[model samples]
Target: MNVSEPDSSFALVREFILLGFSCEWKIQILLFLLFTTTYALTITGNGAIVCALWCDQRLHIPMYIFLGSFSFLEICYVSSTVPKMLVNFLSDKTISFAGCFLQFYFFFSLGTSECFLLAIMAFDRYLAICCPLHYPNIMTGHLCTKMVITCWVCGFLWFLIPIVLISRMPFCGPNIIDHVVCDPGPLFALVCASAPTIQLLCYTLSSLVIFGNFLFILGSYTLVLLAVLSMPSAIGRHKAFSTCGSHLAVVSLFYGSLMVMYVSPGLGHSARIQKVTTSFYAMVTPLFNPLIYSLRNKEIKAALRKVLGSFNII
Candidate 1:
């Protein structure tokens, strides 16, 4: 018998074809308009927050500083996914493997950073309300800067090992990613080989970051609520309610969707349902943030009025 060396090279998939939401022509048209409008609003809303915080001196406190950084993050965060989604709504949504990996990396990193930033924000509120006497010292400029840097650094670094490992896997099978964004679960599922080790590691790390930061935010807010209830003036109580209510709403939207997605590997949701769920948090949340914080809070409203008043629009 003729001796044949084992086939050394495996057929590799060069790109992934993303089967986004609906296949109907009418529905796709509607979705295209919907996603386009949503992206515009996300950019405008977050950009406004960032500019307001930067230009106004009065809103330069620790709370606003963190908010500015968060708004900037939101801009980057939504941009990482929405543009591709917009284009996909109209035509074939094919992305190269390298492009898909970059999307996954930025998307995860920014989302994780948001979780940590939200916790830091809650801690800031707790100290301001419960430990007023020491709040200034506890949250100085340097410390706030440190917290921001840590969030960015840790967020970008958190999933590096898992992503690199996943990317290196042999994706020599099906090339269809059955969702809107470049999610890790879908990407991993396409590999020619099973990756129990990488899967376990990624899931464990994701759960830790999500639940750990969420719990910290909850604890901080509980103490803040207690301190707010003990405050003597009704005006002070109303102010706290306004700020805390907005924050709680944002937190719930973010974590609720995240838990459903990442609590287990895939949870067996259909592709359409997954797309809608992902869009709710990833695309819609950023649009709502500026509306919630600026329009509801009397302080932010006043600051915006002061700044915009010079143009006489208000």
Candidate 2:
């Protein structure tokens, strides 16, 4: 049904012109080069992790498995918006309504997946640290695979209803999307008719995902921390801290920028600010996650060396 306001004369919008960063050409070109470099690094960093995990057998434990999955998801997560954004930087980029909706779906879907993945990672850490005896039993290969599948499935399912509801609304005019991505706030602003119900539902769903998994992660790490502190050996405690520290660092980076971009006041209100904030979570986060895991992690570094040495690339 093509829903539109009865009294309005505006035609249905077929496309949205993403007016990204209104700046001088010199600035635009600089940003393009900067972002392109970051994107390349992000892909290579995450891709290298996947390759290392595939080639190295010693790192085939549950923790590395989760790390590999998270890296792959990070690649997808950043790629969902970065490439198109890069193209838009150099040209008058416009996206059809269908394309916009797809971008919105995959971007948020993958992001939601990260929330669950983080929680799962915490749970893995908790099991390994808090219940070492049962860690192997609880987080077995089959169960780990199932949990991985659950994260992906749940993440994709998380935002399906909200996107569908938004798409069905009568976006009858103002084809300009003031930001680089097809975010919910900007799209909601363009609805022709009253949509408070859907808007509220969308926000509720988003909060449920963000806060729900956030709480789970918090709980998991709390247990892990207490267990680590209680350990008798300094070596054991230091090892525990090292593992949890990397995961926590990533969790902080992901949720910090995300809350600023998506959950803050006046969401999608300021185009220029939104663009910068989104870049951090989408582009910067992905690029840094691999570095956090590999650089801080001796196991990952060893695996990387083995992988590189096998190929004689380094």
CA-lDDT, candidates in order: 0.87, 0.89
Report the number of the highest-TM-score candidate. Answer: 2
Task: Give me the displacement of residue 117 in model 1, in angstroms.
Answer: 0.4
Q: How does candidate 1 score on lDDT?
A: 0.87
lDDT for 289 (candidate 2) = 93
Per-candidate count of clashing residue pairs (backbone under 3 Å): 0, 0
* C-alpha RMSD for every candidate: 2.6, 2.3
What TM-score do all the candidates reach, one by one? 0.94, 0.95
Error of 2 at 68 (Å): 0.2
Off by over 4 Å in 1: 1-9, 306-314
What does the lDDT read for residue 70 in candidate 1?
88
What tens-digit string does per-residue lDDT give for candidate 2 at 1-314?
98865655657789999888778999999999999999999999999999999788888889999999999999999999999999899986799899999999999999999999999999999889888998888898888889999999999998899899899888877888888899988888888888888878877777788888888989999988888888999999998998889999999998887777655545434677788888889999899999999998888898898888888898
